[model samples]
Target: MKFAVFFLATFLVASQCHGGSFRSFPLEMPTGYGDGVSHDDVRCASWRLAVEAQNIFGFETIPEQCVDSTAAYIEGGQYQSDSKTVNQQVFFYASDLKIQDNDVVIFNVDGTVLSNIPYYSQHGYGSEKFNSTRYDEEFVNKGDAPALPETLKNYNKLLGLGVKIIFLTGRLTDKKAVTEANLRKAGFHTWEKLILKEPSNGQNTLEYKSTERGKLVQQGYRIIANVADQWSSLKGGNQGLRSFKLPNPLYFIE
Candidate 1:
């Protein structure tokens, strides 16, 4: 009886440490899939695992990649390769075993979630005639811009996970106070840092944001994820392990 009790206790501890059963799908690309697989392929693979997880464990989790796909087939399950063999294998493990919420995430300010679309529209700055100074002034003055629903949801999720949030914006440092207020009003309660562009810094948006991220790394922050709307906000050195680009059709920044 004592041995039985000890074995049960050990099993329970192992299960708790592993965070239940979660299968990891193989990341290996098929031979004909080319030297580099597309992002869709990776996402599809993830979705496949999510589907299996739902089926086996009754978890309702869905992969973010299939959120917009029209085909229910792809959304439902991963398609088998032409070779009649499953290209991916799922491995069960703990979710937080690798990178937990304690890791850091870098987010871009403007188009990412601040929802500057309406503001830009009200100011008459279309995609063609975007003036940075005018937009910045209006944005700072308004201080009540709405947040993007999808991105905002993801942001809140990250916060719930205990991830450190850092804002790296192209906005001028002078507007820091207003930006902070705006973020707070928009329900972003806490963050590690809110970095803005120095007025004297002549670097472009890409360069400036990249340098800021590098600074975070120098300060001993492990950036596990980067979320932004513009590619410029993501390109450059000190990039995180994973990047998620939100859609931005308003204006392009170099």
Candidate 2:
């Protein structure tokens, strides 16, 4: 009887250590196919990164990557291409703009979602006009766009906690001023890194970003997490980066 009791106690302790609470969540990509983003869902890639960082390291919140027209636009409605495997027409229509001043919308299109046609809509800087050359500027700015208040709030909280914050994106780099104005309008402030895409440096764009993330890792700055709409970005990041994603129905190009 005594031996059995002791073994039972040991088993219970071991079980707890290996259970959900004891282990990290299985590394899975964010769900793409959904009715759309729900306020309470809290499952976007960016949000996932933030949550993981908070849980693992004592970080405050997750950072975000905001793409702009220059990055999405390929040739002024000529069909902007993404680095993801899927081919998509990315556009952000003004009609899709906020009907209410504070109205917010979340896009989610992945599995079982529509396969073809443009995914997102935009104003003047349509995906058609997207040019990779614009990112030549060292400092890329972010612009104000409709965003989830929750995301901004969490990012702010993280910053307030003394965590160094940075921004990364495949957006064109030259339009830093416009991007900055947009981000401010969207309620973001004082970001550290605003990484943007540059002309292909002989390597595939996907490989380039992956290499960069590795370099950042070697710099001794522990990457707590990464959030993005695409899988390539998630895969390219450091092993320590907790990845989170949101709904991105559009296609991914590289």
Candidate 3:
């Protein structure tokens, strides 16, 4: 610290003697930064990794500094690249599975197969608080969310390989029509099952999804793989033979 101060002082004194302007440098890093960029971006990148690994939990919104960084990651192709890498690994695993008439690949709707980028981008890229009502009315009900390109490719490949697809979504039963319509519109043309949550059932994602997938197992369906963006949707009893978690730096649900 002393050496840095002395060097800076000497630099300023030399500049003055030479009649040259000294460039400004802050002694301390600022908390906030320009145009949403910040040191927190570096920190938030690690934070996001933790979030993906399920080390971070119950985050209702993203860190304020990460809004821009997360947005850039989503819009600037990194998200797709990351998805491609995960999906490639998924294909390798799914391709090796022995063929069985009862085998099925279970998928989550929101962030796994389809993207809500339009909705999230509008909602501060997860910097803002989550509003279920607003999200449902303004975004989900429209039934036009686009398919994530990489997951869509994986879906097609799995389908062509004779692996049955099952959509197990947290979307409410009331949304069945719009969600189903949206699935078709988003290129998920066929699936063995499109299970939606009943609004009256008051279970959290882990419990609800576990119960649902467990029921499938009871009915003699061999779960080939389970795929979702949230760890809560992936972990739990009857979590399939394997699980693929896609990246989601947005909101975290319990």
Number of the top lDDT candidate: 3
Model 2: lDDT of residue 23 = 23
The digit string of per-residue lDDT tens for model 1 on 18-55 reads 12333434344344453364545545444444333222
In angstroms, the error of model 3 at 239 is 0.8
Count clashes in each candidate, considering only residues at least 3 apart in sequence or on different chains.
3, 41, 0
Best by TM-score: 3
* Candidate 1 structure, TM-score to reference: 0.60
For each candidate, give its TM-score against the true structure.
0.60, 0.44, 0.85
User: Candidate 3 — worst ten consecutive residues by lDDT sum?
Assistant: 5-14
151-181 per-residue lDDT for model 3 (tens digits): 9999999988889999999999999999989
The better candidate by TM-score, 1 or 3, is 3
**Global lDDT of model 2:** 0.38
Instruction: Rank all candidate structures by their lDDT, best first, as comma-separated numbers.
Output: 3, 1, 2
Q: Is candidate 1 or candidate 2 better by lDDT?
A: 1
RMSD of each: 17.5, 18.5, 12.0
| Candidate 2 displacement at residue 239 in angstroms | 3.9
Better of 1 and 3 by lDDT: 3
lDDT of 3 at 127: 80
Clashing pairs in 1: 22-92, 23-91, 24-91
Q: Write the per-residue lDDT of candidate 2 for residues 168-223, one digit (tens) a residue.
A: 65555555567566566656666656665564556554575677667666766565
